[model samples]
Target: MIRTATPADVPVIHAMVRELAEYEKALDEARATEEQLREALFGERPAAFAHIAETEDGEPVGFALWFLNFSTWRGVHGIYLEDLYVRPDRRGGGHGKALLTELARICVERGYERLEWSVLDWNEPSIAFYRSLGALPQDEWTVFRLTDGALGALGAPTR
Candidate 1:
């Protein structure tokens, strides 16, 4: 079963995030604290949302963390799925698909134009799964980012 995550699920979410980072060989970069997650997910104004997947008897297995983004061309909102992970041992039982299906339903119900996420280039299984679901890759586009010292430098006032 999949359900909207509550504040009580923050720790579990954080753990899964760490697991995901480990799977991607980037566990050292997974530094999200429970306090930060609580503030972002259950604060006065939420910056993101998540859904938790569980077994019929109630053991959590996976989660999908996402947020809304706007497309100037489409003039509609789209969901940017930040992370989707299922316990390694529990994979192949449809938990990942179930999470994505829920996200797709949210997009349709809310009139969103698209649902998208990034996968590590090495994650062939995930790529295959997404392709099987009719998701096309925007290979022509390159992703860029600014963070830490660079971001701070950019924001600083010049003399």
Candidate 2:
């Protein structure tokens, strides 16, 4: 079962984030704290959203975290999935698809023009799974990120 996340799900979601990072061979980069996640997901004015996938017994197994991005050309807002993770032990049970299906449902219901995300090229398993769901890779697009020092430097005021 998939349901919208609540404040109580923050810790588990954060843990799954770390687990995902570890799987991606970048555990050190998963530095988000539970408080930060809680604030982002359930803050007074939230800019992000999350959904939790649970087993029939209600044990959380995976989560999807996303935010909205506007497509000026399409004149509509789309969902940019920031993270999607399912515990290794819980994979292949359709939880991942269920999570994504819910997101797709939201996009269709809200008149969104797109649902998008990035995956590491080396993650063949995930790539295949996404492809199986009819998700197309944006091979023509290159992703660039300005983070940490680069971000701060560019945003810093010049004298």
lDDT of each: 0.95, 0.96
Return the TM-score for each candidate structure.
0.98, 0.98
Question: Which portions of model 2 show Cα errors greater than 4 Å?
Answer: none
Error of 1 at 103 (Å): 0.6
Would you list the clashing residue pairs of candidate 1?
A: none
lDDT of 1 by residue, 1-159 (tens): 999999999999999999999999999888889999999999999999999999999999999999999999899999999999999999999999999999999999999999988988989999999999999999998899998899999999999
Tens digit per residue, CA lDDT, model 2, 91-157: 9999999999999999999999899999999999999999999999999999999999999999999
Model 2, position 116: C-alpha lDDT score: 97
After TM-score superposition, the amount by which residue 141's alpha carbon in candidate 1 deviates from its true location, in angstroms, is 0.5
Q: How many residue pairs clash in each candidate?
A: 0, 0
